[model samples]
Target: MPLALNTLKRPGPLSKGGMRITALGGLGEVGRNMTVFEHAGKLMIVDCGVLFPEEHQPGIDVILPDFTSIRDRLDDIECIVLTHGHEDHIGGVPYLLKERADIPVIGSELTLAFITAKLKEHRITPTTIQVEAGDRRSVGPFDLEFVAVNHSIPDGLAVAIRTKAGTVLHTGDFKMDQFPLDDRITDLRAFARLGEEGVDLFMTDSTNAEVPGFTISERDLTPAIDKVFTTSPRRIIVSSFASHVHRIQQVLDAAHANGRKVAFVGRSMVRNMGIARDLGYLNIPKGLVVDFRKIQSMPEHKITLVCTGSQGEPMAALARMANGDHQIRVGEGDTVLLASSLIPGNETAIYGIINKLTDLGANIVHKGNAKVHVSGHASAGELVYCYNIVRPKNVMPVHGESKHLHANAELARRTGVPEDRIMVVADGVTVDLVKGRAKVSGKVEAGLVYVDGQTIGAATEDTLAERRLLSGGGVVTVVALLDPKTNQPVEPLEFLTKGFVHDDRTFAGAEAQVNKALKRAKDDKIDDIGALEEIIVDAVSSTLRRTYRREPVVMAVVVDA
Candidate 1:
C-alpha cells in the first residue's frame, strides 16, 4: 500500500516565477517586523511592525518599512495574515492602512480583535476576516493554513503557506510547552505530518537562538509570583505586556494565593483583561479581581494592581503612576514588579520610570533581583529541537538581529544542516525557492520610513545625516527686520541660539561677537541681495562655531520691503 500524503496542499501559480520570499522588516533586528511572500504574481505580507526610535532621535516616534517598492503593486497583495498580536508584529497596521486600507486582514479571533482595537484607535474601519486553528483560507493564489502555536500570548499561530512551488511553513514566534495555561501547544502532530509529507522551505524564529533548552512554561512563573505576593510586606504592583494573558492569569492566581484582590491598570491592559475574560481565554477567580477605580476604596494590603507600560512608553499607565498623575500613587511601602523583559532600544525610557518608582519609595523588582521576567523566545537548544523536528531542505532564520540569525544558523550547522543551506536575510532581500531549494535571486527596494512630528517620510542617508548633526551640534536662527522700500534691514540684526547653552546664562561676549560679525557683513553690502544674505549668514555661523566650538544650523530670515 502507498503511504498517505499528509502534507499541506500546494495550490498553484507558485511556479509563475516559482516561490520568492522577501523580508520587509524583522530581518537585521527585532521590532518593525514585516515579511513578504511572492507566489504566482501575488504578494502576501505576514506581519507589519514598527521599530522604536533610538535616544538620539529627538522627537521621532516609530520607524516602519518604506513600502514604496510594493505600494504600486498593492493590487497583488492578496491578504495580510498575522501570527499574533505583539506590537512588533501588529503595530504597523495603522500606518499601513493609512496608505492602503482595502486589503483583507486574516488572523485568529483574538488577533483580529486586537487589530480591530488598533483600527478603531486610528478611526479606520478595515475589512478584517477571522480564522481559526486548522482552518484553511485562500488568499489570491495561495492556500494558507493556520496552525496553533504557543507563545507569550495566546492565539499565536504558525502559517503553512502552500503555493505552486511547494509548502513553506513560517513559524511566527513559538515554543513547545506541554502544560500551557491554555492547554494549547505547538501542533507537533501537524508539523510531524508535514515533515512526513515534506516541508519545502522553513522560515523559523531565531530570537532565542543562542540560549539552550526549551522555554519555561507560562505556568512555571506562577510559583515565583506566588513568592512575591505571599512574602512581600508592601503593596504589590505588577507591570507586564497587556496581551500576556498567561501572565495575567498567573498574577491573579498569585494575588488570590496571597488573599489579595486584583485591580488591572492601564486602559489597554484593562480592556484586554476584560476581553480575555469574556472570550473565555482567561478566567481570574471570581470576586478576586476588581476594577482599578474600586481599588482605591479597598485596603492596600488586600489589593494588587496589574498594569501596562512596562517599556516606559510615555503616557502609559506605569509612566502616569511614576509621575503620580494616576488615580493610584505608589507612595511609601509600595513594591512594583517589572514582570516583563525590556524590549530593545527602551532601556533609557524604562530606567527613567524605574528611577521615578524608586524615588517614590517603591521597591522596584527586575529580572534577576526579583523573579519577575522570563523571555518568550525559543533559545538555541530549542531552535535545534525544532530544526530536528521539521528537518527541511533549506533553513531561513527570521525575527531577530543579524547576530541572532547567524547564531541560529551556526546551531543549524552543528545539527548537521550544511552551513551553505542556511541563508541569513535582511530587509528586501529576496530568496527564491525552486524545487524546494533556496537561494537569493536579487534585491528589492526596501528602506525605513520615519515618523517626524505629524508628518511621515522616508529615512534616507540625508535624513540620517541631519539627525546626526542635530545630535552632535546645536541650532541657531538669525532674524533681521528689513525696510519694505529697499529690502534692507530696518531693525537690529540678532541671532537666537538654542540646545547649546546654560538655561540661566548666555555668553555676553559671544553675543557681542555675533553683532560685530553681522555689522561687518552689512557694511560690505554686496550688490546682490542673495549674495549678501549668504555672506551675512556665513559670518554669523562661522563666528559662533569658532567662539562656542559648536556648529548650529543657521536660519536666516530677512525682513524685506
Candidate 2:
C-alpha cells in the first residue's frame, strides 16, 4: 500500500503555512489540463497538456497553457507530474522542456515511454521517475502518491498531494468502470483511505458532470466487437483514438478469435500500441498480427484493420482511406466501424466521413448504431459517489467547461458537501489552503499559448483572427512605384487577390477607385508614404466591401524612387 498522506517525511515547516493552488488551464475549457501546487517557494506542477485547435483558431497546431507564471520561477519547480498518456495530457512537454530540460518528469511506465518517444523527436533526454499506483515520491516539501484511476488510457492515476498544511486530491480524468477491460479498477479503496486522512481540497474531473448515470464499462464492448467480427464477411476496418489501448485490445482479441489477421494503421496507432505492447499493457497473440505489406495476399474476410481518425481528423488514416488517398482502401462489402466516442465539435466531419463510406457501399457501425464506445469521465451519479467517498472539505471541479464545472459543484452540494466550500473559478484563479481550510485566494496571470508550425506562443489570437479574415474574405495587395519629386504613382497599381471572385472588370474598377484615392492624397500634398498608403487602404477596403460584401486585408505599398 502507498504510504498514508501524513506518513511521508517532512524536513521542516515553511515560513508561510499555506499552499496556493492555481489552475493554469483546463478550467472552463476541455483541454490543456494543468495546475500548480505552490507552498512557500517550492512548487509542483501537474498535467502539462495541450488542446487541439478548433475551426476558429486557423493555422494554430495546438493550444498550450501560458508558461509566464513559471518562466522565471523554473528553478522553484519541484517536478512535473503527468496523469496519463493522452495527447492532451502530455503534448506540451516538448514546449515545456525547451525552456528547462532538467525538470524531472514523473508518470506511469507506459506514460513515461510515450513521453520519452515524444521528447526524442525534440532531441531531449531528461531525468524521468517512473511511478505506479501505491507508489510514493517526494519532491521538495510535497509528498505525492499515485492513486490508480481508470480512464480512456491505461495506467491513468489520480494524485494525492500532501503538504505540511493539508492534503489535496486531484482526480486526473477518470470514470468509474467496475469491470474495466484490463481489470485495473479505479482504486476506490485508496480514495476511501485518503478520505480517512481527511482530504482538505478535492479536485475531480468534470468532463461529464452533466451526464447522467454511470458510464458503460469497456468490458461491455466485447459483445459488440464479437458481433461485428462474426457477422462481417468482408474486411473489417476499425477507427478509434490511437491512445485507447484497451479498446484496441478488444479489437485484436476479436480478430484473433474470428481467425482474422490484425494490421494496425495510422502512425500514432502503430507507435502507441507498440509502446503499450512493449511495456506489457497490451497482449497480442503471436501470429495473429500481420504487416500491411502482406495484407494483400490474405483474403479480405481474414483481415482486421485497426486505424485512427475516429473523430474525423482530415489526415488521419481512416480519413485518408475514406478518400482513397491511403494505401489501405475501404470499398464495397467492407465494414467500417467507428468504435470511438464522437467528440462535441467533430460531429459534422465524422458524419461526412460516414456518409462517404456509405456512398461507397460500405456498412457503417458507430455509437449511433451500436454499443461501442464508452466515456472515460465520470457522470453525475458517479460524481456524487466520488464526493461521498473522498468526503473532502472543499470541492473544486477541473477539466471541463463552465457548464460542467457548475453542474459538478451543484452535485457536490447536493451530496452533503458544503455549498460555500465549493470554489467555482475559471482559469488563473488560485485557491489557497491554510491549515486545512481552503478558500479562493486571488488570481494569477494565466492564459493560452498557441503552438503553430515551428513556433510556440508566437501565434496569438490576433494572428488567427487575421488568418480567418484572409481565409474568408481573401487578400488584396496594392502597390505603386511613386515618383519622389511628384509624390505620385509612376506605374500602374498592382493588385493580388485570393479566395475572392477573380473578375478583371471588378478589380479594374476597384483599382481605378484606389488610384483616385491616391490622387486625392497627392492633391492634399501628402508626402509621407504612411499617410498615402492609408488613403489607398481605406479606398480599396470601402470598394471591396461595397461591391463584394467582404472585408479583406488591404496592403498598400508606396515605393518612392
- Tens-digit lDDT string for candidate 2 (391-491): 99988889988888999989988988877788888777767788777776656677789878888878777898889889888888888788867766777
Q: Highest TM-score: which candidate?
A: 2
Model 2 misplaced regions, further than 4 Å: 1-15, 481-492, 559-561
Q: RMSD to native for every prediction? A: 6.2, 5.4
Candidate 1: worst-modelled 10 consecutive residues by lDDT: 1-10
**Candidate 2 versus the native: TM-score?**
0.93
Clashes of each: 2, 0
User: What is the per-residue lDDT of model 1 for residues 1-561, given as tens digits with 9 covering 90 to 100?
Assistant: 111223313222334558888888998778888888887777899988788776766567788876876888888888889999988899888888887888889898888888888789889898998988899988888999989998989999999988878888899988887788888988988887777777778888988887777777777777677888887776898899888888888888788888898888877887777888888888878899876678778877887888888888777888999998987788888889888987767899999999999999998888858666667787777778777878877888898887788888888778777766778867777778988778776666667788876778745557666667666766666676755444456665666766655342334455455456545655766335566566556766676678667676666766564
